[model samples]
Target: MSGPIPVADYMRLALAQTPQVSDQNKTEINTNEQGYYMKQDVFGQGGDFITSPEITQMFGELLGAWGIQCWKQLRGPSKFNVVELGPGRGTLSRDMLKVFSKFQNVVGNDISLNLVEISPFLSQKQHEVICIPSEKLEQDQKNLSPPSNSYQQGFSKDNGCPVSWYKDIRDVPKEFSLYVAHEFFDALPVHKLQKVDEGWREVLVDIKPDNEKEFRFVISRHETPMLNVLRTRYPKLFETSRNHLEISLDALLILEELTTRLEECGGIAVIIDYGHDGTKEDTFRAFRKHQLHDPLTDPGSADITADVDFSIIKEIFSDKALVCGPVSQQTFLRRLGIDLRLDNLLKAAKTEVEQDQLRSGYKMIVNDMGTRFHCISLFPKVLEKYLGRLKFAGFHE
Candidate 1:
């Protein structure tokens, strides 16, 4: 345990300990037993950071509109899944489902909600907000069958839409699905690699000799598997002038799974996160109480994340799916009619506090998240021509 390990390995070890609410032994997530994400409430004002969905209903509502449009483009399938990766607090799901409810008759009755989440505490939180009370789901939670892929199941409080929970995306039934991965890929573990005179070397985490609690970064002396994979899978990364970069293999694998599913079953995917077009370097960092924190300090105490390299995403989907705008969040939202939504909300505001809240949320999403975050969409390649013929809501200038 004292030996140096790959950064990705360290991340997995740290995140693996995120809280399981059902675990009787661990009551406090801030303790050594907890991990970065599930250790405590890590979203909104009191948590480590805030996400778009938590910021305002509009973020999810816009996404809901996008989803419905996508569903229509797919010819309004009789049965489809709305699979959300990392359904934090289940806020976006709730918002999207509320939108989905209005068109139940058009989209047909076989809509299912599948959430890919691991933290027991967060999953429970998602359930409370997303699902109506169900004794069956409660019993399933208490005595989960070992063989079932879904650990819990229920129906949406607003629409009576069935919802299911799975720890991994593969467990979600392969069907026509509208996928959402807001801020999901960035949280996956990334291996920091440095380009040396001879070849690529990996930056690893090691225990400081003087203090067991402290950790430091060390470069591997020899070539590693990650280096080889990086070279083979994405040679363009090496072409970059930057000497140091972080790559998330988990993210690529998830994209592969998503692309395959879309190819086979027919679907669309939206990925919204803070990232770059493979131009930047050294973005692996942590946050605690809405401030930047040392990732190695208190290992699992803070949320660890890295900026996504969106260029690689484009590369992955190049041949398989039609990759649409990895556009700025501001542009996407504006194109999606966020301004109109804001105006309508402003009109409906009953008090100054309500109006201020709406305005603030709009500023955060449009002015802050707008510029920082990026949005990308994926559709089956068969729709390439069809998509071109139509003006996609968010991609245009």
Candidate 2:
């Protein structure tokens, strides 16, 4: 509040602070935003951004089908988890749960849903869409007790499968879980590093001298702690020709945790995001009302993100698991039969509006998002041979 800070700290402030950055003059400020997410609704046409699931039911349906197929590959475990990280508005989970509901007879009542969400506002929204209040859940909460690991628990409205909420993935029960992280890694805090004459220096945010309300990027005059760690951990990144790039230590740590889970628990993960293969640099930006916005102009007024480096994830996954293709969303979806699903929906359309939506949604996801967004998967290394022979759907080995 009094001095220059890291970009990651600014982001945490922007995302969680209720008062304007101008309120820096105040002695104290509220840490938790008051109904910010409730008012912002930062997804879909009316919000700052829109995800694929918001564009069409097909997106979720296909992912749901993918989950089932993966579970089948897990030998139809007697009990397992379907966990989603950063499920916004629960659209994907809702659609996936619907598909899972149809397979109850085969999967039995052993499937559980666990959502790793940090935002209370979004978590409530997710709960509203994915769960239905029931006497059994209430009884379980009262007569028994909710699991200590979760803040809330319930039953899926679609199939009465047990559903739980966790603030962190580590808190989720250790089970053979299928993890889905759609556009999650990009949102994690990233440290902007620049190659300086001596070494790498961190990019920081400082209040403009003339305008206290405004922020500007400033390079550190001295090496920061993050710079030292990056040098030690990824010395090769410094060897690149590029002078500037962004790296998310948080993202790398999370990927390592996920890989450890898959290696130890026998599970899989599907990660979808718009990212580079360790080639591009300076991709951090913001969006407001579906348009690009200056991230430093008005903090907390927009959604900030950076392109994920899939190469980093691949490296981590490859260490302990069977890393699959970092394929384009187009390739992934087409492999999963999006075209056939679209054709079927088009044939059933009752009006021009429905047909147009179907056609446009298909094109947007396949052509627009399909190219920009990439999908990667991780399976336990034990299945490397089995999966190599058959290949994971939507991802060529």
Top TM-score prediction, candidate number: 2
TM-score of 1: 0.91
lDDT of 1 by residue, 93-114 (tens): 9999988887777666778899
Task: Please report, in order, the local distance difference test score of every candidate based on alpha carbons.
Answer: 0.83, 0.81
List residue ranges in candidate 2 displaced over 4 A: 18-39, 134-144, 234-239, 385-387
RMSD of 2: 2.6
| TM-score of each model, in listed order | 0.91, 0.92
Instruction: Put down candidate 2 lDDT per residue, 230-275, tens digits, no spaces.
Output: 7898665566677887888877777778888888888879999988
- In angstroms, the error of model 1 at 319 is 1.4
Q: Which consecutive 10 residues in model 1 have the weakest lDDT in total?
A: 19-28
